[model samples]
Target: MWKILKYSFADLVRSRWSYVYLAFYLILGFSLLFLNNDLSKTVITLMNIVVVLTPMIGTIFGIMYFYSAREFTELLLAQPIKRRNIFLGQYLGIALSLSLSLVLGLGIPFLIYGIAQSSEIWDFGFLLLVGTFLTFIFTALSVNISLRNENKVKGFGYAILLWLVLAVIYDGIFLISLVLFDDYPLDRFTLAATMFNPIDLSRILVLLKLDISALLGYTGALFQNFFQGSGVFISLGMLVLWTVVPVKLLLRKAIRKDF
Candidate 1:
């Protein structure tokens, strides 16, 4: 598993698209920070970028990686290796490589600015966790989608659509719900909605750190208190679930796959 993961990581690093993507993220991160001189504004902009871009990049890269490696995957199947190991190795390799790039591309700038400005370390830490976990979640989902379809275009499209639904459409639905339920107590509903999408959870976590939970209304306050009371462990558990569930489903498919 370790060897396979290392090789997979190396392959990812050598890909031209990897460099392109890294440069794009780095430029965007620096640009956003430069445009917003205020720490709170900077954090909000960073969070928005993370919530929107990280998953899109993760999903597209993951689908492309697996589809491009179809031949390699087939060759590996011919060897005496467990399907679960191969799938997991590849998954971990992609997750780690992309997550590392994200940290270097976005995280370093955020840290430098945060430290120089004497900003809250907790917000920076939360951003790091959110970025990595968001990658893991999208990668896992993308791998599952890739394995389910033979056509690379179709698989990639499905992954992008899934991301759109979760990251963007879900928020729209929540907004509509809030408008419809203006007279009802919807804090619990909003909490449930946040749980359904990791992007929203990530936003809530960062907003809470800035002491702006009240702006989120009742549901935002609930999430703020939830994270504040539970801290890193809760977020870690959520992230672990995000990675584990989809990978587990994919592993079951891989083990039973005729190939």
Candidate 2:
């Protein structure tokens, strides 16, 4: 398992796409800081970038990795190694490699700026955790879809559409709901709405930490107060659910697969 993980990490490190992804984030982070010397502005910019890019890269590369490794997976199945081990080893390897890239790409820059400006490290830490978990969640989803379907294009399309729905469409719905429920106790509804979309929860979590939840309106304040205590654990647990359930279903399918 260790050997497989080592090789998988090496492969990811050698991939030009990984470097390009890292460079893109690093440049974006630095550019934002250069453009705005304000710590709050830098943190907000970083949060937005992480929220948008982390899942995008994770899904795309994760699907590609699984699909491209079909031949390798087949060869491994021929060996004496257990199928479960191979599946888990590959999943962990990919998750770790991608998480490391995200940490380096976004976390490190945020840390440098945070320290220099004496910013709140907790907020930045929360951002890093969000990016890491988001990557894991999306990667698991993409890998599951890829394994279940033979066509890489279709699998990849599913991931993109899923992202769009969770990140964009869901928010649009939330806005419409806010308009419709103008007088009701909408705070609870907002919280319930967040449960339906991890992206919404993540965005609320980050902004709440930055003391910017007010921008989200009344429901945002409710989210801020509700998640302010043990909310971190709840959010983390939700992320774990997002990763585990899909992978569990996928693994069951893979084990029973004729390949």
Candidate 3:
């Protein structure tokens, strides 16, 4: 597993897209900070981007890597190796490489800007943490989608559709439901609904950590009171579950796949 992970990560790290991805963040980080001159607001901007972009990138990259590496995967399968390790290694490699791009891209600028001395350090850190979780969850999901569908077009279609539903459509429906049932209490409904989508879960996590009272509003206040201490753990646990469930399904599919 380690060997496969090492080589897979190396392969992806060497690709031009990796550097492009890294440079994009480097540029985004510096530009956002220089323009706003506020770490807290900059973090909010990043949160919005990370919540939507990471999963979409993860989904596209996961399926792309799977199909692109078909020949390589076949060669690995021919050797005496556990099927799970091969797929898992590849999945981790793509996820980690993308994650590195995100971290280094954003970190260099913030560190230079003196985030260490700033009080928003934890908030920024939590933002990055959520981004990493999102990378893992979506990559695993994309890989699972790829494994199930051998056709490239269909796989890509399904992956994008999955992202769209979670990122945009879900929020649309959630809002409509809130309006439709405006008279009834929706505190628990809203809370549970947010957890169901990783993107929403991440957004709420950052908002809660930042403690923007205005943004958190009434519902946010309710969550603040309910979660206080253990709520962080609960949210993180759900993100972990989001990543684990898909990867476990991927492993199961890999094991049974007639590679």
RMSD of each: 2.3, 2.2, 1.3
Question: What count of clashes does model 1 give?
Answer: 0
lDDT of 2 at 199: 79
lDDT of 3 by residue, 41-152 (tens): 9998999898999999889988898899999999999999889889889999999999999989999999999999999999899999999999999999999999999899
lDDT, model 3: 0.91
lDDT per residue, candidate 1, 26-106, as tens digits? 887788878876666776777878878889989998998999898999999999988888989999899889998888887
Model 3 regions more than 4 Å off: 214-221
Output the better candidate (1/3) by TM-score: 3
TM-scores for the candidates: 0.90, 0.91, 0.96
lDDT of 3 at 63: 89
Off by over 4 Å in 1: 111-117, 217-224, 231-236
Better model by TM-score: candidate 2 vs candidate 3 = 3
Per-candidate total of colliding backbone pairs:
0, 0, 0
For model 2, name the residue pairs that clash.
Answer: none
TM value for model 1:
0.90
- The lDDT of each candidate is 0.82, 0.80, 0.91
